[model samples]
Target: MELIRAIQLLKLNAVSTAWVDAVWDCEFTDAEPLDSTVEDEIKEDVKVFKKVYKQLLGFSKEDSTQSVWNVFGENCVSVKSLVAVLACFVLGAKAKSSSVEQRRHSLQAAAVYLLLLRIPGSVANKVFHQILFDSCLDIVLKCWPQSAGKKRKKETLKSSQGDGKSGKRPKPPKKVSEEMVIDEEDDEEEEEEVYFSAQDLLGMREDVCSLIQTLLKLLENFSLRDKPQSADSCVRLFTELTNLEPLVGELSFSEKRDVDKLQSLPELAYHGLWLLCSSSNHGEGNECRRRVFFTDCCTLFLMMRKERAKPCLLPPSQAVCNARDQAILFISQIVDEQTEATLPLLKILIQHICHQIVEKSEYRASGAQAVGRLVTKMPCQNYADFVKWLFNYSLNTRVAFRMFALDVAMVLLAQEEREADATLEPDLASYLSHRFLVRSVVYGRRSDVSPTVRAHAMHCLAQCLELPSHNATKWIHELFSSSSTAGSQTMMETGHSEQTLKRGETAQKTALTFRTIELTKHKSLAVTTRRSTDELPLAAA
Candidate 1:
């Protein structure tokens, strides 16, 4: 109680180094162990710190007018001193000697401090913000569990180091005792059991979630207009958070409760980024800064997806899908509002999507949908570049991405056709009508390695052939001629080795012949020389 009174007095009087040192030297015990049944001294220390934190922020139940900056101003040495005291406790929570419970209390105190900092007219000093941000981020990262193999390796290395002594150990005798052999086997068993228990893992995840929630709240309240530097720092924090992965292993039956908890980490980090992007004020002369911010946001989004793809037992959760949709919606909204300014960021996002498609990531379908949405929002002039990119990838060597790019191109074309007023640049128009794209689609449909790719290519070819400006006469002729040549070639091969022809090959020939006949009957073609199969000069069976 006396300590609380001293903090209140400091609010009125000018704070000095002596008072700061006294506060730091106060007997605040570390948190108790997790398994302890009773918490006595640590609980009192936590309450005292919470009271002091409220006092420093001028958050009072009785007197609400008092403010921290009112006493020492925003940049005074006294404010820095007070901030340092709180930051010290926050950092101390990350110490190796600190138990999980101690870390939790320290983080709770930090959260209170950050929460109060959100009040208007609170301390805006850069030093004060940096100190708290760094401390909180450090503690959160340390508390987040890393890969199991990494943790085991670290423990094993520590165990191997013999009491930190530099000298080599004496060699064992040639004939070891039976007891010695048993002890060695027991040591191996102990090393193998280095993983965290269910209780410890649960506690660590709770701490991470709590601290991340606090940091996210702080970020939401951060005034980007006045604190650009702080905004950058928050961006960095979320970027790092997105890269954090869960423990690497299959979730045992005991650890199922952790699935949702672990899933919440990425969702929270994603929401923080979404908040940053949505709340940014894109005024005149800030285009460069806006670009950097949006780029970082996009990069962080991709990084979270990458981290989620790592080997873990956590199935693809709904939280992840919702987060992804939210991100796409956010980007789409920005592009819709400032298409010109956000074009570069859009390109970056599309590039990442293309990368995902190439890698056959599980999120590739969503990525393709994102591309389609963003492209629909883009201006006509910008369509040429994206069209060119899609066409190039439609013929990609990777069959899956080739199919994906073809689908995206088909969607873009369909959208353009639906928008009656949309105009394409002359260069793009000519390029789209050229024979190269037709040939690429035709090749994919006829000779692609995968059946799925071939099917997608067939659909995309139909869309291309339906374009009003496209002259299907040449492509139709080429398709029929190629079909004829392929048919004649198949007949010769069958005649040369009728017994060697595989059943799969024969079925493929039949399917290909039917697909060719279907294309020839497409209504868009005005050919008059349609020939029946019996009149095409093939030998009768």
Candidate 2:
């Protein structure tokens, strides 16, 4: 069937092979008239092609094409020979498609496997990953939801399409894109790095990290993106992971090759990784998340430089767009005012994006949004200045996702900075932001921050008062002095009481706690330095 379909497709342009050129000159002996078997073979080829091609690519059958179907049987040779020819033809289609569709017709892989008996379908679904087809396949692959393999309470999608027979009839999904060459003629060639720690040649962390890096770096590579093999990197990465003891032992193997591996790796592995990453597919029948999907994603970003792709990590083709945007925003957060070491990662990631996006005025704005998201997860209040820089950058550049950045920053602001003495966690920015909720002060007096963001900060801080007065006052002196500007100034005005404070309470209870900050008519400031019944006064209008 596969051969028949391929042959029919070949007949479309008829002057030669389905590809731009003619099939390699056949060495037929002085034409002892073509046998009738040749006609059957041709019909069979057309039938198979129409079946698998339509299903996998949403491609339509071209009419009146020749095939090589009927030429088979004991007369044609053993099933093994017939199968050999079928495999070769499909592989040819796969290779030709790399240049033609740019995707390996990955979606139709189920059909290829059936042809090879790797699966139970009526026809073979094998396809080589053409970068273009893989590109769109990556998008459709993302749609599978991590749960594709899960047994839902709802009726599960039957694995079998039944009878394994496809026809001239159209499949439900009929969308089509532009086309180009075919894979058969390319017969071609082309083609993961895994470092096993001495700790465990079989340990999954390193392998997992490498796989993640492959996906990330593929997205980061930016240069190979246009060609059909763009996803080749992802495929390669996933393939390497599959070979690792952890995945192979766990997933053991699949009837279908794991396509999520990384286009840069192997087609099937890329698909598996995608299954692992999504909520739906991750938890489906296969349950990729049972091992930890989110951890996989977060760890992918947290990888030590050595663990990631050589030079740097990148995301897969589909992830290229989203990952690039994310990496851009992530880098901007740690770049200037924070840790200078992060500059290297930022530079590398920047190299992987589209040149147009990299240099556009909008990138400045994107930087701001990215920084905002980063600062929320970072370790310092001073980073708000970074947020200011970002906001100003966004203001100047007019980038998209600004609101998202501001939202992330506001979430971070509500968090109190980590202890000055406690050694902080590594690398998510350098310090904790103050948990203050005074919007007017955070946004208005702090003027550098956005008003809406400050308002959110205020809302989060206000929640603290509800903790009960004893608790609220317990930390009053520290809350003011430790991380807040108001706290620091108040400490200076009144020497702290000699009383040794206890833990787990609000600062309001302190002997000389802040009652209210009243802005005097003059621009200079007036602060109330005692805990009292009144709310803090607003800054002078």
- Candidate with the greatest lDDT versus the true structure: 1
Tell me the lDDT of candidate 2.
0.30
TM-score of each predicted structure versus truth: 0.53, 0.29
Q: Give candidate 2 misplaced runs (Cα > 4 Å).
A: 1-228, 232-406, 413-430, 433-457, 460-541
Best model number under TM-score: 1
Question: Looking at candidate 1, what is the lDDT of residue 496?
Answer: 31
Model 1's TM-score against the true structure? 0.53
* Model 2 error, position 455 (Å): 4.4
- Lowest lDDT block of 10, candidate 2: 523-532
Clashes found in each candidate (C-alpha, N, C closer than 3 A) = 1, 118
Query: How does residue 333 of candidate 2 score in lDDT?
Result: 34
